[model samples]
Target: MKRRIAILGATGSVGRSTLDLVERSPARFEVVALTARGNVEGLADAAMRTGAKLAVIADEARYDELRDRLEGSGCRAAAGAEGLVEAASGDADWVMAAIVGCAGLVPTMAAIEAGKTVALANKEALVTAGALMMDAAARSGATLLPVDSEHNAIFQCLAGSRREDVSRLVLTASGGPFLGSSLEQMSEATPDQAVAHPRWSMGAKISVDSATLMNKGLELIEAHHLFALPSERIDVVVHPQSVVHSLVEFVDGSMLAQLGSADMRIPIAYTLAWPERMATPSQRLSLTEIGRLDFEAPDLERFPALRLAREALERGEGAAIVLNGANEIAVQAFLEGRIGFCDISRTVERALGEIDASRPRSVEEVVALDGETRDRTSALIAESRP
Candidate 1:
């Protein structure tokens, strides 16, 4: 019997990489469902190729197009947020919670509630709704596997170890494209320059996050949840090589690190075959060819987002939700040229300061808080507009 799978963001980079692996070892896995936000063509093509039982588009307006494209494929087609939730909650043993932002929070929670193992790639889901979702997973017995390379590295390093014996987790960063650039240089940086990441190929928003080192900060909050560690226990280092994905230091004066090629597929494959390794076509790591690896402390002055993230995590009172929501708006604004690139962190900081982050007891409240923060951040952007 093959392992049944439903990839929520099946048209994304991670989704495509996962599909690549599944396609090669077709007999090991069964594609149960595939979903995309608005890429009807990509979703339809994937469904047709995989022979999935269902395909969903989160954008309701694109439903007819998706349906038409998937017409003769015999796979069921649906649209809207409800459609996404249905696909996530549908019959499948594993669901890839890779949908972009807080939009993924609900469906991810649905999968967790249904007790389906979830391969989580959306850091915002945990950033915005950590407590609520983690609690839900505990109640439902859902296994939330980490797919982010950094978190996945820590996960692999700590395997079979006593959590109580683990001292701290060290998450490595590539320092993005602006590793040595000054704050002045960064302020004048263009979106194209910002998104030109040195190591990983990613979507625009994440690429910007990486450029600002905000990506590593968000990962810190996520590690707090995933590893049950506090902000003080999680650390970050600027590793330009991206070879050392992450490191874990034990209480017994020892450390373990997971190094691999700077490929998203490595971690995706890790989560796919979790607790058991699987063969992947990902490029193997060659320490000899790579030669030396460099590491340094993140420059908080150049990238204040990382500092802001730590402060938010330390507060632990729904600040992560506000940070994520504000960052999303600011990053998009930056990408659109509505705000200067450096203003992204400034906007998030202002929003965090102005917004009252009360602890959310439920997912509904978390979503509501996220919306409120986005609105406030938008207002700030408008006020800053010339």
Candidate 2:
């Protein structure tokens, strides 16, 4: 039988990659539902192309537009948070949680609560509410497959290995666009320059996160939750090549790494065909042609976001939520030219300093803390303006 699928954030980069794979292997999967934040055109188009049974728009105001767009496509339309949750919890054997930032938390939780095999592309879902979500997944028996290339690499490397024998997980980073730039250059960097990731094709916000190295930090938090490893055991390294996605070091001194060309489809395909492998059109790695792979320690002096993320992970879940929330606000400000590129980490640092680091015991508390952090961070940004 074909795997029934629901893709949240179906218009985004990772979601599009998934759609590409599913579209290519029509007999292997059935698109049950498709959702997007506000891209009704993209959502409707994907739904129609896949013959998805349902399409959802997260913006309630766009319901009419979405519904009208899907009128004759044999796909029903819904809107707002309820619509998103409905799409997630509907009859889908697998769900791709690709909605970006904190916005993904609810729908992602819905999928987990429904006990679907979830391909997690949104790091913020875990970064902001790791413990709670993990607990929910455990209670619901939901299988979470990491979709971030680094986390997926670690996941693949750890397969069939005894967890107790694992020494550490090393997550690779592309070091982003500012890897070689001086502090002064970063301070004056433009949004266009910041989002110009050399290796990956991604959405704007994630591209900015990569540029700031906050993406890796957030991944560190995610790895902690996904792998059940402590902050100290997980390390980040700047790998400009982006060939070796990540590595897992065993206690006996052996290291296993998952290498692939810089393609999101490779990992997405892995999750889609879990317990069984599937072929993808991703470019195969040619080690001879790409002769060298260089690795360096991340420069905390230049990218303090990584440090802030690790500190937040050590503090507890509440702090992690705050760190992610604050960084999201700050990244948007930087993208909008309201703040200097360097101010992104500074804003996160300020918020972390002022916010209470108490652990959130429930999803409600996590959402509340995230909201409070975003509000406080925004006000702090305003205070520092001019």
What do the candidate models score in CA lDDT, each in turn?
0.91, 0.94
lDDT of 1 by residue, 1-386 (tens): 78899998999888898888888888889998998988999999999999999999998999999888888888999998888888888899988988888889998889999999999999999998888788888999999999999999999998899999999899999999999898889889999999899889988889999999899999999999888888888999999999999999999989999999989989998888877889988899888999999999999988899999999999874898999999999999999989998899999999989999999998999999999999999999999898
Task: Give residue 205's lDDT in candidate 2 (0 to 100).
Answer: 96
lDDT of 2 by residue, 225-302 (tens): 999999999999999999999999999999999999999999999999997889999898899999999999999999
Task: Tell me how candidate 1 scores on lDDT.
Answer: 0.91
Model 1, position 176, has a per-residue lDDT of 96
TM-scores for every predicted model: 0.99, 0.99
Worst 10 residues of 1 by lDDT: 128-137
TM-score of 2: 0.99
Clashing pairs in 2: none
Please state every model's RMSD to the true fold in angstroms. Answer: 0.8, 0.7
Q: Report the number of the highest-lDDT candidate.
A: 2
